[model samples]
Target: MQLILPLILFLVGFGAYEFFETRRAAYKIAHRIHVNGTRGKSSVTRLIGSGLRESGFQTLTKVTGTYPKLVMEDGTEEEIYRRTKANIIEQARMLRYAADRQVDAIVFECMAVQPQFQWIVEHQMVRSTVGVITNTRLDHLGEMGNSLEDITRALCNTIPFNGVVFTSEQKMFPLMEKIAKKRGTQLIYADPETVTDEDLRGFRYVEHRDNVALALAVCQHLGIPREKAMAGLHQTVPDSGALEVFDVDYIPYKRIRFANGFAANDPESTILVYNLVLERFDNGGKRIIVLTIRDDRLERAEQLAEAIVQHMPCDYVLLVGDSTDRVHDVLTALNFPRQQAISMGVASGEEVFEMVLDLTDDRSIVLGIGNMVGKYKSGTQIVNYFRHRSHITPKLEEETRA
Candidate 1:
């Protein structure tokens, strides 16, 4: 009992010191923008960071996406190697890194999924002066919640105290506003209409208008001119997992179009991207959807299977990763033609690519969705295979990796 008392006191003192140090680190930066949401958190974080840097602010950005990366002030990125599983404690490192650089601003993609951690990350660790929630979508249901409303509420836990919050979420703007008001913050809607098609043409890769608009809103609020911000955003480097379609010319077969949508973890975003691919490339070709599953993410695979069966129009559904047969069963039960669902259980990326080629004749549009990277289970290998074989220019090859 006597030893426990001293241990408790020591712990309390250590925590107080950490809290003070973290807050001091955060205060050293002129701008602290914390980005959260179901989708596009990494993209938005990168966009804001690039815009700030272009506007002459020494900015640092961190994105916890397909991989954790620390984008430095000069736009060079350093991969953050994780010694263990991801934790909110990593935010402390980000704060220290920013403070050491004496950055003018720091943009962080919120890595917390649990509700309590989300609140603590914002209220305690980051204490961002500006907050951005890309959009609310049905994702991470097991952690956030089942309903979209629940996800929105979980995301709102990142709303800063007495700071402006920005979002492109139309359905739940009111709810976010209510939460922001209680926190003495204002919620601003980032209307996508304001972002012109001309503005999107500057991007070298596929970028959503909603994401661009939201980033623009935050940059504008930071006193950057729209023209300047757009210019910076144009030059912004895409996340390594950003949507990119590559055209591969097989020696024996005709050209194959590979759309890397593996980073779209949620079904809704995947559906939207699939539809966009269909619209963009009207070439008559076999359409294939590769759904990569994880042993731990069977539920997500099931959700994606339903979305693919109901919404996406494709000739073949190639199931990869762990428990593919289970997802194939789910697909069949959803009325997806059994013959069309091919379960490539835990196949190597080369094996999957070979099967995709075997199924296609002349022209084929293949969309790789689901997990980007997993334990010995990743869609990136398949993507890399296509990327190596594709006729994409050296510049494109460089950009995609960035």
Candidate 2:
């Protein structure tokens, strides 16, 4: 009984200390921007940080994407080394780091998917001055919810109390606004019409118009001029998993164009990426789809398989990554041609590449979708293998956007 009292007292004291320290750290920074949503959180976080820095705010940013990173004030970024699986507590540590640096602003990509964690991250850890939702979509449904409305509600957990929030999600604006009002927050719609194709041409990658427009709106609200903010955005470093294309000569007579859309795992985002890449690079070649499936993301694999059957017209479907048998079965059950769907179970990057070559003719378009990183899948390796073999002219380098 005596020991129990002491243990309880120690636990309570530690909890109180942590709470005070975290809030203190958050208050030390002048501005805090919390970015959440299903699709473009990392891209929007990087954009806002770059623009804030350009406007002379000593900014720091942390993005959990294909490659997790910490973007410093001088626009230099360092990969965030993790010793274990990611946790929400990292936000507290990031805030402490930013407070120590005495930065003028910090933009964080929301890393929590579970609705409860999302609420705790924003209300307890970040307590952001500005919030950004980069468009809610059908993603993390296992953690967020099953429907789009459910996902939007889960994402709105990060909407700052008594502060302003922004989003480019036109369809869900009404629901978002209702939630924002209840929290004493004002929601603003970022009009993508303001961001022109000419502005997009300045990018070194195929950045979506909605992402740029959303980030621009956040920056403008922070008092950065559109001209200056755009200049910074143009110079912004894209996430490692950002949409990129490579045209490679695989053999003496064969050539292939590869587009990396592995990061867009959700059905809506995946379809958009498919349409974008197909529109830009379809050279009348055989359309090939390489879908990488993670063991834990079998549900996503099923979703993508259904979406592909309905939307993405293709000549062949190559299933890679862990537990390929399940996804192949899904494709077969969906009435996808059994012969066309090839299940190369847990294949290496080179093995997948070889299969892609075998499926391709003289000219082909190969689109990679689904999870980028997994215990068994290495989308980075596959992308790098193609990049190393690409002999396209110097003018068409990896830096070339569209």
Candidate 3:
């Protein structure tokens, strides 16, 4: 009985100390932006930071998507290696890091999945002046909820008190607005249509218009000129896992075009990128879709399979990773041709590389989607294999044959 009192008091003291420390660190950084959403959080965070730095602010940014990285004011980023697993307490540490550097602004992608942690990250740790939600999509429904309304309500938990919020989510704007009103925050909806083709052409790599629009809205709200902000955005380094395409000549007269869309895990984002790739690439080529499954994400695998079956048209569907059986089952139930669906279960990067070479011919386009990194192969590893194989020119092939 006596030990309980001391334990309770000790915990209370620790909590109080953490709270004050977080507040002190937050006070040192003037402009703090918390980016939270179903998708594009990392891209928007990077864009906003780049835009601010272009406007001459010493900015610090952190992203928890694709991979965790701490971006410095000089545009250099260092991978954040965690001794333990992911924890929301990292945000408090990030606040101290920003304060130590004496940065003018800090932009952070919200890392927490739980509702309480999200609220704590916003109200206690970051206390951001500007909040951005890229969109409300059906993702992490297990943590948030099953319905879109529930997802929106959960995402709105981070709306700053008496601050401003921005989003590209048109369907849930009313819910966001109501939350902003309750919190005394102003909500701004960024229309994706406002970002024209010319504006998109400015980006070095393929990027979604919605993400660009949300980032532009936030930068403009912060008093940055659209032109200057875009200039900085153009210079921003894309995340290593960002969607990209590469062309490879594997042998004489045979070529393969690879589009890396593994980072877009959700069905909606995956389908959107699939359509975009179809529009951008050569229509005459044989289209192949590679879906990598994760054992931990069975629901994701099933959802992606359904999305592909319903919307995406392809000559072949190659399945990889631990959860290939679940995907194969889904495809079978849908009456997809057994021959058209190839399950390369638990294959290494090299094996997958050979399989792709065998499946594709001259004028073939391969779209790699689903999880970026898997147990047997990583997206980077597969991409590298194709790149290295492509280097075997006609002359090299002839030399080998001779």
Candidate that would win on TM-score:
2
Per-residue lDDT of model 3, residues 16-59, tens digit only:
99899989999999899999999889988998999899999999
Error of 1 at 60 (Å): 0.6
Decreasing TM-score order of the candidates? 2, 1, 3
Write candidate 1's Cα lDDT for 345-364 as tens digits.
Answer: 88877888898889988988
lDDT, residue 72, candidate 3:
92
**Candidate 1 local lDDT, residue 165:** 92
Error of 3 at 242 (Å): 0.9
The TM-score of predicted model 2 comes to: 0.96
The per-residue C-alpha lDDT of model 1 at residue 377 equals 48
Instruction: Return model 3's CA RMSD, one decimal.
Output: 4.8
TM-score of every candidate: 0.96, 0.96, 0.94
What is the C-alpha lDDT profile of model 2 across 1-402, one tens digit per residue?
Answer: 989999999999998998889999999998999999889889989988888888899999999999789999999989888899999988999999999999999999999989999999999999999999999898887888889999999999999889999999998999999999999999999999999877887887788899999999999998889999998898889888888888887676788888889889898899999999888767679899999888898898899999999999899999988888888998999999999999987787888788888887788889999988888646777777777777555544433444
